[model samples]
Target: MIKQIDKSNNLPSKISTISSIRMIFSYALLKKKEFILMLLFMGLGITFMMISPQISRRVINILENNDSNTSVNDILLPIGLGVLISLVGAIVLGIGRYFSAIVGTEAQYNIRKSVYNAINRQTFSFFNKAETGDLVARATSDIEMTTPVFNQGITLGFQSIIMMIGVVVGISITFPSISWIILLAVGLFLLAISFCAKRMQIAYVKSRKTFGNLTTVFRENIIGAQVVRIFNSQEKEIKKFRKENADFKDYTIEAIKWSTILRYSGWIMLAVMSSFVLIIGGWQAYVAYQNQDLSFDLGRFIAMLMYISMLGMPINQVNNVVMNFVQANAAMIRVKEVLDAMPEIMEDTNAISAENIRGDVEFRNVNFGYTSTLVLKNINLKVEAGTTIALLGTTGSGKSTLISLLPRFYDVVNGELLIDGVNIKKYKIEELRKQIAVCSQNIFLFNISIADNIRYGRPDASMNEVIQAA
Candidate 1:
């Protein structure tokens, strides 16, 4: 059995978005050094991008104030420095992306592994209620959705904020009078992003659910193809699939619609920023020039334009980050639902060890059910050591359910099942299971060699034992 993490209380299906994101980060940050290195590289890369613009502004300023005191080297120096820093930004971004990929891949691997372990620990009732296809989608596609946060979502969001602050600060220091206008535009831009985030989250949640349903429908058709062929219902199955496919498409389009809104928000912010600089800031700078004040000049006004142009990249990046994170949060909710289900059988913490066993078994007034209604009721049976008994029953008569009780697959609800005269639940579950084996009615074979398949329940079985069993 996989060792389960007991720290986080398995929250319900309605788990909060921030909590889901926090859970995701817990998985991603497992490799401490890798996460730290990724942040370090990301900070360095964005720093270069930020400084380059400021240096380019200095070049424009030097040329605007050109005089006998200003040399050619003064003109060439800031220009060269700006270009050099831009190149460095590109290189640092490459390294940062490499580390981000490593962290993202590691996170995906860890989450997949943990989710698989959680599934293995689930009881038989879990499979009875869960669609195979829906579970498969959650384990694969939904988990894949969480990965973009590490890849582009986190870095892009951080970069966007840093750049926004840089632009506002640059604008404030250069043209302080109209800095408030720039701040207001940025504030509006953030409000638009926040509005879009709520819409995207709703759309993503619906889309992921519809996709799971669609997957379930498709998997059912494929797995039951023989039944469909026997009943000549292929057309009916195809029609059902098409309906589900349409639902998936509609929900996906809804999500895309919200993403488009976010993209347009960035564009709208850019337009507003440009208008403020070219129109409002222009008037302020003219007044300053008329007053013969050197605090704000035409070159500095041009620098404000440069900052406006630079703000576009972070705006677009923020759009992507919001979309990625909101979608990822929706996916995380689906994944968390699987981990939150309660199993029927929990091994007793104070159970006795099951060592060498006599083959005696007994079921005493046993009443059991997978749900509220009992499938097996008021049953009493006993078998002595070295004796065998056959269970004779019609279909749906609980014969399989009775046999399933011995292995504790589903615990008996209202009676005692004993092995060797001691209550089975009193024995340590692992050791108790190791003492008994049953050949189930449902015949399922794994994709492996025949000998391996024969000895699957006992992987340590020798070749002779496997051959004899086969």
Candidate 2:
């Protein structure tokens, strides 16, 4: 089965150049020698790219001379050289892509693992604030969005920049007269791209955000299918999903419009610039032909045109890199949000660890609340060892919140909670939780054998023990 991530709307947050560069290098997770080699191969591949146009120019010049004295070998020599250069370029570029693929895949794995671990360490309260579906999207789809962008967009994007520089230098050395036209057109293209890109990015962000909402809707519908049927509100749920899906489509179309404008405008500028250069070069060649100077000849004019074409060659690729970069940055930000989360409950370094806990629980003048408005207040309670106690309260009366305190999920805002006359704060968080057994109201069963599920919390328990527990 092939899985495809629809990242059309899965776009980016702001990508600050410096921070993003730093993040890229860090997340790339390549060893120094390997990273250096990847860059070397990409550079060598770009160097070979520069040679092809020059070879074409040389071959054109030789052919244009129209001299009987020029041998067949002379014509074949540059053509042969061009073919050889192409072969070498292919090898180095292939090697570069190979290295990029490995690194990209590895980086994606590390990020996914890190995000999963982060989510696991979070307090139960964290999930109440963050959408479970959005977090899932960040781990899967968002993490996935960065891999290809890194491999194709970032790696090739680097080479594209180098190629652009090569084109500039090649033009300056070979045809300085028309270099300004290429340069001017390029300048305008950049300015125009910059002006429009912000809106494009925003649209992409909206699109991806809607997709996250879509995921949430799907998850809720599936998980709450029983409740939906019980209420006979399946149609309402379907409508909600459709509305979110439509919003995603609309946002994606808006993003496509912006990207299309940027992409096609580049080609248009290249066309206009090529024409302008040709007209000016034609005028110069005509004067030279009339004067019989033979300085600005057909060969040089043809070479100039080839140089212009080469300059425009990488524009499409560079544009693609730019779009990929924006999408990846958006993903990076969401993933970063997960990595940056600090668990509300923390284990204290100096806390004591108990191998065995005596069952004596007391809440002394406890006052607690998720916020300033207290859900629990001024409580005094004790439950002795081997005694069974029940907490009976009306809804919103903090029954669940009070039980949650036993595991140190949230600390009381005031007063002490004691286990065996020892303040719970002094107990190691792990040791404290291990001493208690909790069965949540919303239960989940792992898809495993009954015996396995019975001993999940105590994997060492024998089958006899598992049967007894079950």
Q: In model 1, which regions exceed 4 Å deviation?
A: 1-15, 284-296
RMSD of each: 4.1, 4.3
Q: What global local distance difference test value does model 2 have? A: 0.79
lDDT leader: 1
Candidate 2, 1-470: lDDT as tens digits? 01122455432323443354457568785545655677789899889878777788777777777888999999998899989988999899889888887777767677788888998898876887777787788788877778767677767787878887888788777788778887898899888678657767777666667777899999999999999999999999999999999998998898788888888988999899988987888888888878997665565567667667776657888778777876776566666767878888877778887558887999999999886888888989999989997988888788989999989998889999999898888899887888889987877789998888889888999999988887
Candidate with best TM-score: 1
Model 1 / residue 55 / CA error / Å:
2.2
Over 1-470, each residue of candidate 1 has an lDDT whose tens digit, in order, gives: 21122222232234467778888788768877877777787778777876765676777788777677999998898888888888988898888778778878888898899889889889887888787888898899999898779776876777688778888888888778778888888888788888877767776777777778789988888888899899999889889888878877876787798789879977987897688668887787788888987776566677777777888898888888888888899888888777776666888889998887786999999999877999999989999988977988899999889988998888889989998899898888888888788888788889998888898989999999998887
- For model 2 the TM-score comes to 0.91
TM-score of each: 0.92, 0.91
- Give per-residue lDDT, candidate 1, residue 16: 65
